[model samples]
Target: MRKPVLTIFYQFNPWSTTIGGIQTLINIFIKYAPPEFAVRLVGTANDKTQPILKWQSAEFAGKEISFLPLFSLKNDNVRSLIPTTVKYTAALLGQCFESDFMHFHRLEPTLAALNWQGEKTLFIHNDIHTQMQTVRDKKAILWRRFPAAYFAVESLLVPQFSQILSCNTDAVKHYKERYKSVSDRVAYIKNSYDNELFYPLNQEEKEVEKRELAQKLGLPDDTRFVLFAGRLHPQKDPTLLVRAIAALNDPCVHLLIAGDGELAAQVRTEIDTSGLTGRVTMLGAVPIAQLAQLHRICNVFVLSSAYEGLPLVVLEALASGTPVVTTECGETPKLLTSNSGIVCRQRTSECIADALRKVLQHPEDYPIESCVETAQPYAARTVVRDIYSEMLNRWEQRVTFAVKV
Candidate 1:
């Protein structure tokens, strides 16, 4: 039998050195794609001059997968937005026509490819409405200016997709409730972590790793580390973690920020203003292996995001047997067990500080076994296999129906 081709579209260089949850999820989909199907990826090229419709291939899980990187003008300013959209959409459509199924990782790219008459899937990484309400980035500028247009995309256009997947269970419920017309298509497919790379380290191993990290970052060997590993963007609210660390005011409690982004400057200013200069270390986007090691050695992992779908960092931390202190967002409240971690009642620095203090003061309360157990279900291979099975089943059913018709 000829294998079905699944083409995934998202804006950004997936092959880049530094990537976030969406890109990670894309890679998982490619890596664990059933042997019965072929996969192709469409993403923006790093080089602006990179030609569109040029085919490339990369090996994943001992199999070759096709890649198509499109080029577009930068949409940093308002003047270039329309042209960038048009160019990207045209380029995407040209490549998408031949694929058996299309999977989109972002709303904008999915919106652009709506004209394509094929089986389409949309993955919701974050709640779009919540993002629009809370985020004030370049993308949000247009969304804010045209609320009705955004609503139309959410209400009318979204249901056009054959399937809708959300990493957050709450988001799946939200989509089902809001878009009753396509409720059946909306499902929860969780984000996963590399369990092989992220697992509990023994006490002696952890101490050794901690000492090495301390030496590299020039921190005291006995320092208690609190880690926040994600983009320093408005949605992430990275400064909130900085403020919480300062508010805790424990001389030995140190924060290690592993990622950098748009609010990097602002976060630095907050750290300086709060007099947390030496206490906070900015590692600036460490690799996954390094991040996992940080997770293993840290006293607690913190996420102060204004909103999230389901953060992979939190799962990675749990898999590394590290307790978490995260604001009540997305699936964190449901995801965290009382014996495993703490979820803040409020999104305030004081609340986060108190939560952190509790976890740090009584690490024994959140057992390493409990934390690792919490992360087991989100293991990469298991979740990706389940997702692939679901996609394949749906595709097979559609094909059977088409033949019957």
Candidate 2:
């Protein structure tokens, strides 16, 4: 019998600026999909005008890979709102016409599965329900109608899928509790890092890149830089990080904000007003190639996210032999148990400041090499195999049940 063809749909490309935890999960799916399964990765280009297709026949340690891009029809930040609806609508209609099974990676594609009329697997990365609720609760959405609209749209779509693959244990538990279905329909699979691209930097390479990075960012060789990778959005809470750094009152403790987002202006304003301009360096967006150097140069990495489903930057930082100081959200505490890093009790500026200070003071005690070793199990290859084995076992059980029937 022929192997099953799995169609994996994502809202954005893996290389895009918005790439983070969700993107990492998609990359792992591409890396770890079983060889017996022919995988088709579907995503939209940041723009809304063209379709893209990237094919790879070679396996990542015996797992096959392929990519398909369905660009949005409009060129706007609301690409997911418009292009995703159109592209995924077409994708679903096409899939239904041909009759195929699909596994979608985010909320937008969950809508597509409603019309797919096939076995649908929903991969919930960042919960749209939570996001919409957050904006509404904080009154950040401004227009009361939009939050209601998003909530209604989400309510109309998310529950229609056949199965849901949650990114972390907390998410799985939340879904099961919310939906009142604790069965295999909602399963927890923690994300993994791309060890091929993100790993421990050697001493020589680290020294060279650290000096070069300091030079490029206009930092003194003695400056102690803490890194904040990922988006500069309200959710990421870079402003909170700035407040935390300011509260620390340590002149030597500098912060480097990597990546860009909608709240860039606000973050800059916070840094300026707080008089942390000299202490905080905004590197904007650093290339993936230079990320290791950035991680190496920093004394520690920090993630001040309001929420997360296992932030991939944390894993990347750990893999790069850098201890982390992150907010205690999602799976952070699980990873921090071994003293690889410190998990703040809350996302408050005071808590974050205390955590940062504690880590900075005992940098030597927080073994970077130990952090790297701790993160190895979550490497892309290893996680991929775990996922494949999970899916394969489930499939085998279904086959056995069918045979008995």
CA lDDT of each prediction against the hidden true structure: 0.79, 0.69
Residue 161 deviation, candidate 1, in Å?
Answer: 0.9
**lDDT of candidate 1 over 91-193, digit per residue (tens):** 6654444467888775665655667777888888886657667644544336666777877767756866888988888778888988888899898877898
Instruction: Give the lDDT of residue 394 in candidate 2.
Output: 64
lDDT of 2 by residue, 255-304 (tens): 88887766788899999999988888877766666776677667789988
RMSD of each: 3.2, 4.2
Off by over 4 Å in 2: 15-18, 46-67, 72-101, 115-118, 127-160, 202-208, 393-405
lDDT of 1: 0.79
lDDT of 1 at 38: 87
TM-score versus the correct structure, for each prediction: 0.90, 0.81
Relative to the unseen true structure, what is the Cα RMSD of model 2? 4.2
